[model samples]
Target: MTSGFWQKTGKGLAKTRHFLSAGLGSIFKKKREIDQDTFDRLEALLIGADLGVEVTQVLLADLKASVERKEVGNLETLRDKLKTSLIEILKQVPVAPPIDESPIVTLFVGVNGVGKTTTIGKHAKRLCAEGKKVLLAAADTFRAGAGEQLSIWGQRAGAEVIRFPPGADPSAVVFDATSAAMARKVDHLLIDTAGRLQTKHNLMEELKKMTRVISKQIPNAPHEKILVLDATTGQNALSQAEHFQKAIGLTGIVLTKLDGTGRGGIVVPIVQKFSVPIIEIGVGESPEDLIPFDIENFVGALFEEENP
Candidate 1:
């Protein structure tokens, strides 16, 4: 990421910065001696952000130990300490390397209203910008307008979209798209699936069947499985991921609406527990708004002054 991209990312994280920094800084605004009261207040703020009680406890324990050791005194110092610890946790998500596979296959999974369809368009735009021959597979045949929505994005991104009618077999769509990708020698194939609840057993079976078609049609295809999550969902996002991971394995996570008022702290527990890298984040409506995830910039933005 360039310096300009970092600046854009910092701006995108403004809401989260305000949420965390403002709350943490207020606990020590008076410069009072750091004590259990400080930790208690900090605990409340972190937990309120839906960081998960267990993870929040771990973070608070570390901070409390630092305070007892006289290493952290004022609120400013405590804030820095928390940021350092958070960086350690945030950096644990494995960075997604550049795509090396020709006709690289990526399957997107998520429930409805997480911007899954829009994300596919953004990704297609990115691939097109990179001069990759891209094709979109709209396998979300169950939903009304899902195919048309993807087609509009495909046109906007300058990528061809292969889709079937509503109620059509999604697996057949994947198989057909895979065949087209092979015949056309495309550089990237982005597969979009129907949005389904995590606990819906029949929908899960449908997803698995789509996965089967990809592997069967193309060798080691569907190289990446990314879950599109709405960061605004907070704790519910974690719950959704648990079932999605169980039903259809996830290789990476793409968080949408980070530009909104979402606490954004939820990313912490998701990565800390699932071990899945946050591959991308959508901050705005434009195709260009879905930017690659940069741990350093994200951590820096999370703790920096909101006005910055």
Candidate 2:
């Protein structure tokens, strides 16, 4: 990533950085030594930052073990140990493979208002900018104006959209979109499905049916099933991941609206729990803001001081 992108990531994570610093700086400002009080404060701070109880416990456990072994003696060492632990958890997710297949079909799934459609637009823009012929499948017929919204984004990205009337069966839309993509021989086909709550069984089954339809049309297609999550939703995002992963396996995740939340630590728990690679994150409103997830840059941004 360029330094510009790194700077933007750091800027996007400003709230999270301040949240961490405010909590941690006070604990370590006096060059506090490894002690029970320090550990307790760290545990509370991490959990408050939305790292989730299990992840917080594991991190603290590792830090305590390190201290017991005399590997960590002061505040700086404690910070380094925590940062290393986070990176290790993030590294558990394997890198996503290259899109070798033409008309690479990718399904975007999530609950309503998670920026699922917006993420698709940003992704389409990225692909179009790469000089690839991109097509969008507006398979979200149930939501009012969902097709129109996708059509607007399709225009913005200079990609063709395949949509049907509202209330039409979503699976039918996917089926037709698959046919169009195959006939047009586009480089990428990005599908936008209706954002149904994870708990809705009927809607989830519809999603599965659409998956089957795409697979039948093109073997091993819909090559990517990405779950779009709202970072502001915190632990609720975890619940959605659990249900969606069970309903239809997820190949990747797109974490959006990080700039709006101080609980960006939620990223650590999501990866630790699901082991799904975070493909991209929505740092800002523009299409250019949906940057690819980089482990080192993310960790660095979390701890780096604000630019003067």
lDDT of each: 0.86, 0.90
Tens-place lDDT digits, model 1, residues 1-308: 79877877877888878888788778878658877787888899988776788789889888889888999888777778888888898887777677677788999999888999999999999889889899999999988999999999999989999988899999889999999999999998999988888888999898888888888877777889899999888888888889888877899999999999648788889999898989888889988898888887887788887654
Per-residue CA lDDT of candidate 2, range 114-139, in tens? 99999999999998999999999999
Q: After superposing candidate 2 on the true structure, give the runs of residues whose Cα lies further than 4 Å from its correct spot.
A: 306-308
TM-score of each: 0.96, 0.97
* Residue 125 accuracy (lDDT) in model 2: 93
Model 1 Cα displacement at 153 (Å)? Answer: 0.8
For every candidate, C-alpha RMSD to the true structure in Å: 1.5, 1.3
Candidate 2 global lDDT: 0.90
Q: State residue 42's C-alpha deviation in candidate 1, in Å.
A: 0.4
Highest-scoring model, TM-score:
2
Off by over 4 Å in 1: 95-99
